[model samples]
Target: MPTVRIPGPPGLPLIGSMVDLARQPLQAMLAAQRDYGDVVRFAFGPPGLRGEIYAVFSPEGAHQVLAGQAANFRKESTLYEEVRSTVGNGLLTAQDADYQRQRRLIQPLFTRRRVDGYAGAVAVEAAALVERWSAVPGGVVEAVAEMSRFALRTVSRILFGADVEAAVDVVRGAFPVLGEYLLARSFSPLHAPRSWPTPANRRALAAQRELYRVCDGIIARRRAAGPGKAEGAGDLLGLLADARTEDGERLDATELRDQVLIFLLAGHETTATSLTFALHLLGRHPEVQRRARAEVGEVLGGRAPGVADVEQLSYLTMVLKESMRLYPAAGIFGRRAVEACEIGGHEIPAGADVMVSPWVTHRHPGHWPEPERFDPERFTPEREAARHRYAWYPFGGGPRACIGQYFSMLESVLALAALLQAFEFEAVDREVPIGQGLTLQAEGPVRVRLTPRSL
Candidate 1:
């Protein structure tokens, strides 16, 4: 057996590497990679602690851990346990046979044919958003919030038949509470036991219940009304509500609830973040913005975008790809060793945590030239063809890849094309710092001035 080599900062007595990462996650990880080469390992938790864990980060190492010997690694128990407590055994948090079953059952809904059905709704909602924004005075609009609203509306229409304008407040009111609890739990050891009586956790759980209530009501009403009754009833909720497993078993109430919750959360928020970052990048690079606007103009000629129009908007797709490469919505994905394994010739013992950060890999010096420059052309078909398949995985890869990637890409292209056709945007302030959290969101509101495009 080849001897395993672990790279990264030397560990301190009793504390492992937690302090360095907590102080500055991005910089710390970058520095570790610089010092330790592509494959690096670091420990966390108190030194000599019974439950201390180690993690590895390398493009090749990550590939090996996630795809090469995947069975040896599993979704980190921390995330599984946390999500189970909040959302139950849905696809996002479930593992093994249950996850496999749910994935098999739900995969049909995200097929090209099914997701293409949503393009009209996406374009319609985006056009409405652009029309509403036309009235705002020339100054930086909060792109993050605006995109979130856009994505929420898109997801609601497709998932629950709700308009963005109508469902915005309900979803907005609910998500922050849920996000706060999830974020707090991610870093704090006291999280699990504090779900009771504490206001934050209580509010989060309440929000979860309320979300379920709304989805349940929508599902029941759709069922009661029968097929073809509701205007947009064929959305994800309806599909899942009526879908059957391979064995012909239908999703029970709890299973339906979990899938709905996952779609509601995952479908909108991450895409919104991606859109926000894309807009931010576009605003910063006016030339790229002009080219994108020109492409939209030439393609649709002022017509509202539809599913067919999406295929012609290749520049818009490149813009989104480049933006995600710079600021991936989900910055990092994590797993844990379920058994002792060798990755990059290094031993990863059972119970150790592993993280593959797109935030780092997407910007790896070895893979991308002039990594920080805002250049959309890098994603041109010719350019994209030159990169390794695993080199630019914004939505992840392998069996566990995000099932809604095509849906999101289509949604983003239509939304951007619609907005660009209707309005010309410029940054109010170009120096906003980005914060990496559950998603890559602006550290503060991204304000952009919008001027109506000459029709």
Candidate 2:
């Protein structure tokens, strides 16, 4: 048997690499890759932890884990367990047969045809957001929070038929707790249960309950309306509520609740982060922003954008594509091997942890020229076609990829086009820090001054 050799950063006797990661996650990870080559391992957990602790980092390694031989890997149980405690058996947490069944039942709803049906709603909400923001006095608006609110409102309106403007307080109340819980789980060992009476954990549990209550009311209202009434209903909640499996089984109340919670949590947060980053990039690069605004102006002519106009807004799409490439909403994805695999001439053991980082891949020197610069032209049809297929996976690749990608893109494009048409943004602080938890967000609120564009 050939002994496998993987290189990594030096670690202290007890703490290993934990402290390094805590200090500067992106920088530390990049340093590790630089020092240790494409495939690197890092230890975690205390000295006497039951299982071995190591992480593998490489683009090829990431492909092997997430796509090449993905059947042999599962979403790490620890991550899923934490999600299960909060959202129950929704698609995000479920595994094996249950996951398979739910995915099948839900897949058709996110298909191109069904997702396209949501374009009008996305446009309407985006136009409303532009109208409201254009009215705000210029100077230091919190773009991060603003975008988060906008995305939550868009998703809420499409899913629950609830007026997001009315439900803002309720959603805002849940964010801090949810964000903290997810952050803790990402760093802490799974064996340490979240119910250990810590203040943060307690707050998370309370927030979960409150969130459940809000979703429960919406689910109940939808259920009462019956199948025929829901047929033409365009919202995600209605589709899930009224949908039946091939075997004629509907998502029961528990399943429905879990799905709703997942959509609410997963649907809006990432999209918001992406849009916030997109706008920030646009503000910094005036020429790119100018081109995008011009595209929106030519495409829509002062009216709200519709599905038909989305395809013509090429510059806006490129801006979004480049923005996401620089800062993917989910910066990294992980999977654990269930069986041994060989990838890029290295052997991966069954129990190893595999990590693919969009943060790293997007900046890979071999694939992207001047990778650190913001260049939307890289996303032009001709340029994009010539690049590696997986070189720019802001939404990921393969069958298990994000189901809401189309909806997300449509929502983002409409919002971006509308906002750019109505206003111009200037960065109040160019050095605002960014962090990663459930999504990539600014360390503090991103303050930007909004100048309404003179008609």
Number of the top TM-score candidate: 2
Pull out the clashing pairs in model 1: 4-345, 14-47, 15-47, 140-447, 140-448, 141-448
> For model 2, what is the C-alpha lDDT against the true structure?
0.75
- Model 2 Cα lDDT, one tens digit per residue, 26-78: 66676776676766667665677523334445555666666777688787745
Residues 164-239 of candidate 1: C-alpha lDDT, one tens digit per residue: 3445566777876776566556544334475468777678778877777776776677678765566555767777
RMSD of each: 2.5, 2.2
Model 2 segments more than 4 A misplaced: 50-57, 163-167, 228-234
Minimal lDDT window, size 10, model 2:
50-59
TM-score of each: 0.92, 0.93
Model 1 earns a TM-score of 0.92
